[model samples]
Target: MKVAVLYEINKPLVIEEVTLPPLKYGQVLVKLKTSGLCHKQLEEMTGKRGHDPFLPHLLGHEGAGIVKDIGPGVSFVNKGDHVVLGWMKGKGINSEPPEYTNGRNKLNAGWITTFNEYGIYSENRVTSIKKEMPFDVACLLGCAVTTGYGVVNRIAKMESRKKVAVFGIGGIGLNVVQWASVRGATHVIAVDLRNDKLELARRIGATHVINAGNEHAVDAVRTITDGGADYVFEAAGNIHVMEQAYEATNGKGLTVLMGVPKKEDKLCIDPIPLYLGRRITGCHGGDTVKDEDIPLAVDLYLQGKLKLNELITERIHLSGINEAFQRMKEGKIVGRSIIEFERSSPD
Candidate 1:
């Protein structure tokens, strides 16, 4: 199979043909149809989240595909089953990570990887979805959509008519806006430096938007909320923006940190806010239970209650992966960038 290999940090991924090892127990072989590019992958590429111990490894965590085969002890899905592959664990065996080999060297891969024509995913990382779900949109269910909705519904437990602010209107942030609006938040304020993203956010239920590049984000959010929003979500993966998101929240409201910052970066905030009922917490893939959440998310999309197609701003092939990352870095993509795969023989 052809896969993108990250041989070193702060370098472009090398696309090469690799030989896949046999599927181990609880693993499933999948022919990927679509893969969603995420900021997390960019973080890993740039070493923004710190050391890269797993160099020369496969990249990507969110994808949709058809089950081509399953290894021993796997029961959650079957051959021909349409599934969403994610990083979050669901209800299956936690299999060992797969190893792939180029002609001369070994390459590493996690339980879930999608930046390839084919992938061997752990049972817990694959969730079977309806055959009718579009691969491009369904792939987003693997992380972006599930994580965004989870942050609002599961993590924050945001109530109706509450004020909400989301910093960074990328894929995850865009979902946060839509979900917050769905939850009946009176004010869904989207903040970002990119006007395109901010505009897309407004189209997808963001009641207002603030271009942080133009105006002060925290002050603008506070002003729009008539003080501070009841809930604030930071998805920019920047330490400074995280601080701003925290400061933009109401004294008694919650601040959910959805972005992963550099490993060495430390967040500084006033301790006095804690004493006054202000709460802050970090999110892990939106606290999503993939088995439960993926299906429900698909149902919502099928019912037209969710906006999946709108989140897709660009689509490209695996060969264009590096340029996709460049666009992400330049803030050129308004929402999600999907990597559509062509069917290939799993040699």
Candidate 2:
């Protein structure tokens, strides 16, 4: 199978033929249909974040495909079922004793992301693919969409009539805007520097849009929501924007940091404001439980509450991934750039 291999940090991904190991217990083999490019992939590729930093590593995490083979003891899905890949591919966390809360187990600690094509980004992928929806859309449930939704629904505890502002109307941020709207936010403000993204945000459900380039984003958000929003989400991963998000919140409001920032970077905030009930929180993978959240996200997509199709801006072949990454860096694309793999015809 042909998979894009990351040989080193800040280097181009090399598409090469590689061998895939047979499926292990509790795993399945998927013939990938499409996978999305996430900012996390770029971060991992550039060594901005400490991940699988070694060379010759597969590097995709948002994937969806058809089930071609199944490993022993797995029965949740069957062969030929259309499914989306879960982000954490490793074993789920054991929900017992100190882990379980209110009669529910905690999320799993799986490592099955969609970065690898076969292993992470190959023509063939090895993992458990849960069958339910179209592979292309399902792939997004693995990461971008899930992350945004998880932040809003799970982390922030958003309620009706709250004023919400989502910074960075890109892939994950866009989802944040729509989810905020769907969850009954009275004033949903979408903030971005790009007009195209802001327009897309309104189309999805943002009641108001702010171009951070035109005015001070913090001021704009404060004016729109009348002194600040109830919840401010920092999804751009930019330190400056993150600080602005903190400042744009109402006194005692909550700010959720969803973007992955540089390890060494830091943001300065007024300690006094926090004492007045202001809360700042950081989350990982949107605090999602894949087994439960993935299905719920899928159902939302089917119900027209979640906008998945509109989030996909580009679809390219497996070989075109490098160019896709280049476009992403240039901010030439919005939402997600998905890679569609063509299956090899039988001889």
Candidate 3:
């Protein structure tokens, strides 16, 4: 199989043909149809979280594919089933991460990876959805849509008419704003420095939009919410934005951190807000229980409720991945981009 290998941090991934080992217990082999390009992968690629001992590893975590084969212990999915591959654990068996090789050098991969023609993923990381679901958009359910839905439903438990301020309208942030609206938040505010993203957010159901580039996000949010928002989500992964999100939360509201910050980065906050009933915390994939939540997200999409189609701003071949990353760094991607492998026809 041909896979993009991360040889070093802040370096272009080397596309190489490597031998995929036979599936082990609790593992399954999948022929990837599409993969979602996530900022989390960008963080990993740039070594944002610090030293990576797992160099020369596979590069993606969210994808949709077909079950080409199943190992001995696999039971949830059968051959030819359509499934979503995600980093979060689901109902199946949890096997060890897979390893591939070029006959000389060993390559590492996590439980799930999709930036390749084929992948050997743990059964627990694969969830079978309807066979007819489109692979390209279904890829979003693996992370973006699921995380945002989980954030609104599970983490914040945000009720209708609550004020919500999402501090980044990218893939996850856009979903957060969309779900916030779907959940009936009367004052759903989308915050970003980019006008295109803010405009997209409005179409996605944000009652208000704030450009932090020109004005103060905290002040804008406060003014819109009449003091502060009930829920403030920091999805931009910026420490300064996180602090602002914290400051923008109502005295008795919840602030959820949806973006992954640098490992050495820290944010200062006053505990007095907590004393007054304010709560601040972080999210792990929006605390999504994939087995239950993924299906729900899929249902919403199938019912023409979730805006999965609009989230895909670009569809690039795997060879153009580095350029995609550059676009992401420049904030050129409005929502999310998908790596459509069919066009590449990798060996």
Stretches off by above 4 angstroms in model 3 are 261-273, 344-347
Model 1 has an lDDT value of: 0.90
Pairs that collide in candidate 1 are none
Give the per-residue Cα lDDT of candidate 2 at 115.
41
User: How close is every model to the real structure, measured as TM-score?
Assistant: 0.91, 0.84, 0.92
Q: Model 2, 284: alpha-carbon shift in Å?
A: 2.4
CA lDDT of every candidate: 0.90, 0.73, 0.90
Candidate 2 similarity to native, TM-score: 0.84
Candidate 2 regions off by >4 Å?
Answer: 50-53, 89-132, 343-347
Count of clashing residue pairs in every prediction: 0, 22, 0
- lDDT for each residue of candidate 1 in 215-311, tens digit (9 for 90 to 100): 9989898888988999999998899999999999998999999887878999989879989999999986778777888899899889988888988
- Which of the numbered candidates is closest to the native, going by highest TM-score? 3
Error of 2 at 74 (Å): 2.4
Kindly provide the TM-score of model 3 when superposed on the true structure, using C-alpha atoms. 0.92
